[model samples]
Target: MAVRSTHSPSKIPTIYQCDSKGRENQTIAADMHGTLLIDRSLFPYFALIAFDVGGILRLLLLLLTAPLAWFLHHFVSESAGIRVLVFASFAGVKVSEIESAANAVLPKHYSEDLHPETWRVLSSCGRKCVLTESPRIMVEPFLKNYLGVDLVLGTEISSWWGVATGFMARGGVLVGEQKAMALRKAFESSLAPEIGIGDSEADFAFMNLCKEKYIVPSEQRVRPVKQVELPKPVIFHDGRLVQKPSPLIALLIIVWFPIGVLLSVSRVLIGSNSPISLFYYIIQLTGCKILVKGTPPPNAKNSRRTGVAFICSHKTVMDPLFVSAVLGRNTTCISYSVSRLTEFLSPIRNCRLTRERSKDAKIIKDILEEGWDLVMCPEGTTCREPYLLRFSSLFAELTDEIVPVAINIRTSMFHGSTARGRKWLDIFFFFMNPLPVYEITFLDKLSPDQTCSAGKSSFDVANNVQEMIGTVLKFKCTKFTRKDKYRMLAGTDGLVGGKPGAVAADKLS
Candidate 1:
């Protein structure tokens, strides 16, 4: 594969290849100005915050403070012509309420998604604030405590004698141009040269107000903003989606299928102890493969005793079965579906064939209590890139340790994941032709830590795990931002289709 560099005057490089650190620099350069662009001193001191209040309960209280402040300012400022004092008192009270809410929402895992650089910049800056539409009540705690921001200017809601009153400024809306204006007004006299970071185009409106406008790159590509054309989104292809398979690959899958069956038979007939042998067998049979990159956790030597969630990269449908063979009876796999055609009750009967509204919590709870090593693909489904999907937070509750696993299926046999519009017949035809060896790569395991509060939302835990995994994997497999999906459909023009060397480079990178 040839690497394309240096765009000529006639043609622009449609895409850019950069890792996380490079992406960060790109965002800052595109949005910021002044000598501080290259200044290392400000890098650590740039505080970052978001728009949300974090959770349901706190969001409610934050919503309440809007009207509460509005009423006070409405009366006091009108009566005394000293509105700053009224707003200041209201801001303080609202800030305290936010602190209380943060305490209530205590024990959240640190997330790289939802404003990670913001936190990094804030922690580095030593001072930060949350600029959200959430009332000052919700924004204050995070701004003052977690982010350590000096100020929070947000909407206010009202409460009457502890119960919220339904009155607020313009009925409590602080979004769009208003949010941008509010932020600009607060920082008007600052000489420190502040840098602002945001995730969306909406954020660009406000971000432009700052000395710099830092736009977070989506999973696939950066997009064209109002005036600035951001970098193209990054496309992460799963190893399983290759187009043609080599001859040796065909032989491997054929040999592995029966071996898996034999292991399953022996486990039942001869009382053999190892179930993972069968799992390996099944994966090989399913036309997929596993590449164990690191040492299996000593604690996970027997998954039955440990609450292990085999958090594998999602690609093909064969993943759950492949992992099941490896784990054997020591674990139970949870999937979105199962075959109605197959009978014979195994411990695998616990599988849910569909995602229903009510069953999720119950299923996750039972699996944890049984001390079973639950196998889950955080992506929930296969996409063009396995790395971009948001991981499920269920692992945070089930186990403290997450075994980071990566799988690369040679897609040469298949057109691509239906996620990219390849049909079932297309996949089957590819299998009928030549096949490629499936490569499963397992990375390091994260030791379980109870750093996040148990009471926090599962999504929060998943977000934390995604970040941790992203840093370790370094291939950007964490959150699938909206931009990521859009880029996959767009495809890379002039790029070779299914070139082995080119695909391999993508995997390693």
Candidate 2:
């Protein structure tokens, strides 16, 4: 395939000016940024790697270069700015860390930023390729895993002894002419790509190679692709940032971090010491919102021999605390791996589970006999998204009266959940949000017909409770469990090597 560029740099035709898309078996080469994604700036993705892998100090260092990065991006070449970001975020960092961030953190952002029209064009092709100026390591996982792209030819970064050198390879940044040459090299023996899509003059180098080409305009009025529209659902992601962190947002978070820490500590102290009647008021005074919807059933039913089992959706580690507060009585929570510090600070009793079915069941029965309502997060782990993990059937087999409690947490800036970060600081992160909202909905208690005592299998009972909660919160239910969650986020079994899960019993005794 061969084509000529008849238009000037500024006059390149936009996607709106060309045919929408086709379902034919054609090959495509689309620029990753601007062309595929709505945003063209590369700082936020780099900032993710900096904070995720290198910690606070490294993230601050990257932030310090923001002004210079902006100047270089505007005054100098875009590649110059990208180089500065790559070096600041990647220098001396482990190659594994970079790969982890790209795999876990960047995908959510990239999926959210996919250009609607551009995706329609790029996704329709049979063999899709992405050519970008960013490091190949940063963009490959998302493109191949989520978008089903066939090839990704991006700028190569240098590394030594499993650590990034923070410098580009001998081929230099894959922009302008470099992208064009790389494209040719990638398809030297294979059939030439039939179509190309780009946003700017820099992308024209490769876009001119295809028989058909379309330019994505700099300003896109079309809405970015919604989460449901994505080719793959991003069920598991690891990062504290609840939203994409532009330079301004990053600076705001940095400035508020210290103040947020103080507020969080105070709130924790208040929650642990305050009386039940005044707990909600005192906590609300600190700028967090707690909303309880639906009616909470009585602590226990006389018809049931055992205490009521509260099956709650997991979000932050504070789910039990809030659920207990809304019920006007405390519930003994099951902690899988709680910190010693948390145990000492909690007013509610925490019972640790052994993960073995028989041992855990005995523990649950023993706790019930001790005159305490039991709250179990059958999902085992916390999921930030609106999807509920598979429920544990152990709870269903133990109790006849089950209350399905659906909880939703809204954060302004920081997420309170993490699979890779310090699990002990989860409450602190939850409190760090400027105006966090904790919404709790207490569904009707499960009838005897829905219990194991009534001929229903434990598995069926567990699924019923899960479906009830999922319907209340409008969240989808999945078969994924704690092991699946850890494998995706932290590369572990979510146990035998880590902190307790968000709903795991806490020692906050």
Candidate 3:
């Protein structure tokens, strides 16, 4: 077997020469910033955390310090500039808030930026570690969960009384020689890691420490690793920013905030109050694009004596609203522990559910018997990925007239949903985009033979509806429930308000 060497009295070879084959037994240290990630810029990630965790005030604070940070980065030192950014973005923010953004938000953004050729080499190693100038808390979750990294060597953020002080600990930013030292300490000896991967001049010191090294070509014209190519699929991510906020995009958001607020409010009021026949056309004038596919079953009020149960693939708090809007009439919506403000701002009448199975069943049955069509997301919570969470059987048992609805949303600037932040803002952020789109697919309604009353089990009917919606949306159906989502994103059991009865509304199905 032959080994590739950087010190062979010849020009160092690119990562392409580092042969990923048979490297599964090797340990490697890979850089996170410019090396593994396609874009070398750090401002956007800092901005994402700042805006998501601290809101506009924190974001503004970060922006004000940008000039000084840029100066220090170019003239003084990259570490000094990064230090200022750390303080501006995270100082005084609650540790829990930062952690939530890390767990729920950063992974999707990080996964979208993987450097294809670089990832080819990094993913082959048996043991992997990441070295970067960013805070470890910010990258740890994503690196470990998505990329199979065993260790993350990065700057450490200090905390006090459960809040971040924004000051970094002892060794400061993990750049230049500092990064090399951390790698050495983690491996416990020199020459322990068999390979090193990096892209910038700042990474040279650390790359020299490994037994062998490979440089990721900065000017190489290679496409980024696509989502389908990632080591693990990013099925769940939570954040209000639909697009990654670069310097220019961040500025636009700051300027667009007030204008978007007014537009969103006006759109909501008009969409809710407009006549059913004109709801689709009227909402588009306010920057909303709605595309309805497949024929929706006629309104139960006119076509049948009993109301219909419309089950949906949850995308946002606005799912029920659009279902009924697309139908041009109000559909009764039931939510579990939905915020009062969301219900108040919404035009669709909402029914709250008590987890007591019998009580919930009665409420649903009574509503259907009244000949009022009802819409609910069987998955319970909004999922951003192209996968459906387990459908709740409760909705299946309540009615024989079951209809499955598939809903998908597209936003250019911000997501309208969150697991750890303000829940009421889901709808507001949704409408804040310049051209938000809603694609609603109404699948064929189930026949009486498929209903729970016809000897089919409740779970069977629930799953049947789930498969139908997933098929049209090109999504995979899963057995994971809303509890699985909350446990990962919010560190809860899909409950809110600290009460057992406060589980998220998806349980209302």
Candidate 4:
């Protein structure tokens, strides 16, 4: 018999909902929020704190129960049951209230740690299942109502109508070997999992049964163990984004900030003509390597060539600086948007273009006509993924002397992405890192026929150049645009307060 909660339909928890023929239901069985989503045991910790017992009594209860809880958690194979019983004894709280509080707070707490890449994979899968040792009441609302996981299987805490009974149901602890058996029973015809991802040894019982198994490593492990090599990089550590700084590194960054600023100003003042080399020198002092591949074209040496346009793949605000330093050229960079402070402090001559296509075209054409080598990122924004955003074809129509420059940025401590509201911070973090490498390569030039022809539009030219750069850097090409990035970062549709005019004015200034 399936037990149903009296809570609203939206908050109703699904314990074991399966059709008669389980063979037809194929799901990607992921672990719960704390395991697969974030690195936090929210239910247990929050329940202890929010228990109805007085603060001192609660503290005393925890102190008294901790040893027994630890013993039960380790000694017993079905430890989750004992842990739940211990929690229920002193909790003095209704399961409904705890469930309500969990539903209210879980989203806000773990929203940032909700791995976008994981969601991207799961969402593409037709159905996904969550199997966890956490209490079903605690994790159900978030996983079902918010994350939309199709199936959830977790430890069941016995209750009397609407009250806690301080005991787990018989054979209810869904953990370890029991978890493996439950998974097997859920599916008929001896169906096997195609892929399994888990963090701890407890999951090994069922994870080992899969064709492909991935273990997320943690310091809690007894010793260093071999992990399955994944196809792509995973950017998570202990359930949080990978950006924690050690105390010594933090202090070093604080001390290095002023020195970096001084060096930057000195370069701007004394090395303006060859600022690229000076910038390269400054970055090298921070233990970064700048590798430039492929020589510039002979015509690239002629600074007076009107049609010369340096088309670069955007990775960070520092892209143009690296390109200029590598080529030893004074170039004017065109950008759609830039922080006002960054614009003021930048060493290169930068032109902020408006969204007005006609005006931007006129400005770009005039700049090219003035015999100034133009440097522009056709993608218009920085993306941290090794993927190229769709390119703008405006520059392709303006000039045919397009030199596609591939820029690859690597940092040991900080990400070099200059997303919205992080331009100055990105630069600060870029310099703070002990070693940040920037690899620049110049691809073959794009001729007029390749870029813009009667049959092929400027878009074809842009795509062709984008493909060449992606091939060289081994980056994936994505359809996401700068507008998509802005909407994501700023929460507006690439405009502030629905006013593009004000935004354009701010960017121009």
Candidate 5:
């Protein structure tokens, strides 16, 4: 007693014709396969009789009832059509039942086209089948690209003489029960549980067949999906992940070079003569004794009016004081300070370069113009270790007689926050410890062709300075290169708090 039709009947056929209870009384039952079987029953029989109403009145009433039925049927059909069309016009699925139906009928690409998150769900599914309105030929080509899915079911497009006819062999109709039937066939013999997603009530029958269901929410109010977080890659400087000193700050160090030297020298010679040698003796007696191995550079007296630029490694704030005290008043040294050109003209007569004016080439030019030799520490800042900072090319801007000097301090205690072996809070305690030995070496001097050049850029000058210092100190001199002492100072900043070789190896490992 099962029925099949193109569409649901407008109404179940009248149970009986003429006789109220005929074969309609038969009993029907459905088995495991959902097929219905019926037991026929006998109907009660009665003699037929005819009854007549007033002829005209009956005719008038029949006319009225026929038009009313027709009007109502048209109204219902139109309403249903509008509803279906409205759902079809939507860009995406909305209702849970409809979404379930669509997913049951579609593949990963189709679901992803609707929403990206569906990719995750589809990937988790062990196996899948796709049912689309498109023809099998069209869908098969696309499915081959994905390759993971097990099956594709779609309309069959009809072609004649290698040209598409206006018709599809299986018809391109993807409506209502058509979608549901395709989903049922795919699931009928499958071991895996089925899942469905759709957007309308028409998909309910298909969705109901699935074990799991997902419905995309309306775009207007859908909660935003959570995104995965990733870590940013770390950047390295000179082959180490260290905070770089700013170019501006380094430039300031160049501008104020003379100032830093003057302040440090003044502190060393607080109550002594203007002669830097007097200050040197005091530092030696104070136990920060510097061991001078090489003779005072051979050309020390050779450069009469020849401007000598003393380029030293920056190890401590006391470096300039030590170098100047050792060199005495014989040469003029540039250190970080304010106003070099102005100060060079004074009676006390030393050059000053302010941090703000580091880029001014005119200042260096004016200093050399006055016939005084220039002294500078190319590693502009005092570092904890025996590393050399890139030198400023402003030295190249000065006369080319560049002298590379190296200062080594054997300290019982290092000072300042820039000092070695002090915690952030304990930095103030560094000066409490007794000072250490100070060793100074005046290495060879070179002419303009040897060190300074207008052809090279400022960065090149910094590199050249590193090379010059490295040559005299007998250590690797690139920006990446570091001595044992520098590694110790780096520890003061909590970088590595042990011996240079061991700590650096551990860090590299």
Candidate 6:
């Protein structure tokens, strides 16, 4: 007869039986899902528990050593495969999770430093490819999705049992000579790249295979080299302006409300022009360096030195103030719009006008006839990039003695454009910097005939002047208008619903 053990149903073991000696024993086994199923056997139970504990300890060790491995790979070995391995060791089921997180933010960081001109060229190229030594797992998505590259070549990382084992693919490393070999094998067809561009010496081997080679200097290893040549009338200096101010300068600006008011009152009482000079002094106190290129032309015979009709590239609100300071004369500015506080606080006279061509022309002509020197930004808005938008020619029709001026503003900490904020905020941020430099170049005097002809309208005059200024300053000429910019920033075309009729007239001309 067979011996059987009786026990409560809840106490039954999944794997337990009585041996020939009638002694109860148990064994270890696995379920269909590969989960370890153990009976009440002491030795096997302890062994399985120890194995799990060892796995946990090994995972913890990898987590602790990850940073050390990354540091060694970056500083000592400089090996791309080692870097990949370091990242791979930490990756388990989280590879997709890591990729999803990187996808959300990495494109923005990559594009911050990418030049617009570079992007234009790359997008226009029919067959574009990215060759990098970084692991394909990291770079491919960005190159393919964001940049729309046709092909990508990068280091390969291996995975095992649904987890990365910190091992590189069979090839030793994808760099230097290896990169060159890979490029040759991949592009075996007769058609090859017409031009090749690279940043470091490591890229030279493969770049040499192309018909033309251009090397982009690495920021870490190479000094920036400026290639564009500005015209004779233009002067270019690259430096930071907004910086920590000296104690004395800072104190003066802080106490400027009292001092400035006193200076204004004294100038008024004495009938002196010292107030204008003092205003300029305050601006210069901010460590701003102003460069003036051309001289003011002599007056015509009958003209009572009719104030110069200054047409400038709009950069910041301080433009009129700085130009007046540079010229050592009070200038009346014509603006489309201005804040109530700014208009009230401004020392110089500001004339506001509407977009209606006839109305604006009448106001501008009256101001000129009054012998008040007029300063205007023909672009109708401020642009921070090294580019110029289409100019409004209404000012061109008002005066023949138009002085084309190019203004370049450089700041280390803040950009002096109103695109990101309001005018007052732009000024606040600008002055907050330690130093801000302003470069104002007065180009040749532009006459109506020089810019306008029988078939050509005042718009021609505006474009001619724009070309002269852009050429001198090495700025790209663009068709973008203030309306387009406003639409981009504020999500509306203008104060009105659509583009202004004045801008439409300018475009037609």
**Root-mean-square deviation (CA) per prediction:** 21.3, 5.1, 4.5, 12.8, 32.6, 22.7
- Prediction-by-prediction clash tally: 49, 7, 5, 2, 32, 10
Candidate 3, clashing residue pairs?
Answer: 240-415, 242-414, 336-505, 380-506, 395-509
Better of 2 and 3 by TM-score: 2
Tens digit per residue, CA lDDT, model 3, 6-31:
35323557888888899898989889
Model 5 lDDT per residue over 373-491, tens place: 56676655554433444455667655666677776655432233232222231212222234446677887665455544656555565566667676666544433223432432222
Better of 1 and 2 by lDDT: 2
Q: List the residue pairs that clash in candidate 2.
A: 334-504, 334-505, 335-504, 335-505, 337-500, 343-507, 346-508
> Candidate order by TM-score, highest to lowest?
2, 3, 4, 6, 1, 5
User: After aligning candidate 5 to the native by TM-score, how far in Å is the CA of 454 from where it should be?
Assistant: 9.0
Model 6 residue 270 CA deviation (Å) reads 19
Model 4 weakest 10-residue run by lDDT: 232-241
Candidate 2, residues 1-509: lDDT per residue as tens digits? 34355457666667766664574688888998888999988888888888889766788899999888788988998878888888899999899988878877888888889999888878778999999999999999889877899999999999999999989988988889899999988887787788788988788888888777788877747688999888768888888888788988888878888898898898888888976556667778888889988887675644344577889999988888888877777779996887777776777878899978899989998877766789888888899887888888898878786888999999988889888778888888898888999999988888888899889999888888888888888888887778777765643324444664343211111
Clashes of 1: 49
Cα lDDT tens digits for candidate 6, 197-313? 454455556655654444443233221112231101101111111222222332333444344435434433232234665665655644556677888554332366555688898
Candidate 1 Cα outliers beyond 4 Å, as residue runs: 1-231, 234-276, 279-289, 297-306, 328-330, 337-350, 353-358, 420-435, 450-457, 471-473, 481-509
After superposition, candidate 5 runs with Cα above 4 Å error: 1-274, 297-303, 330-333, 337-352, 355-359, 416-435, 453-461, 474-509
Q: Write down the lDDT of every candidate, Cα atoms only.
A: 0.41, 0.82, 0.83, 0.59, 0.39, 0.52
Alpha-carbon lDDT of model 6: 0.52
Whose lDDT is higher: candidate 2's or candidate 6's? 2
Worst 10 contiguous positions by lDDT, candidate 6? 28-37
Off by over 4 Å in 3: 1-10, 189-191, 272-278, 491-509
lDDT by residue for model 4 (282-401), tens: 656546688989876653436445757889998778788778777665678888877776676667889989999999999999988887778899988776656677888898888777
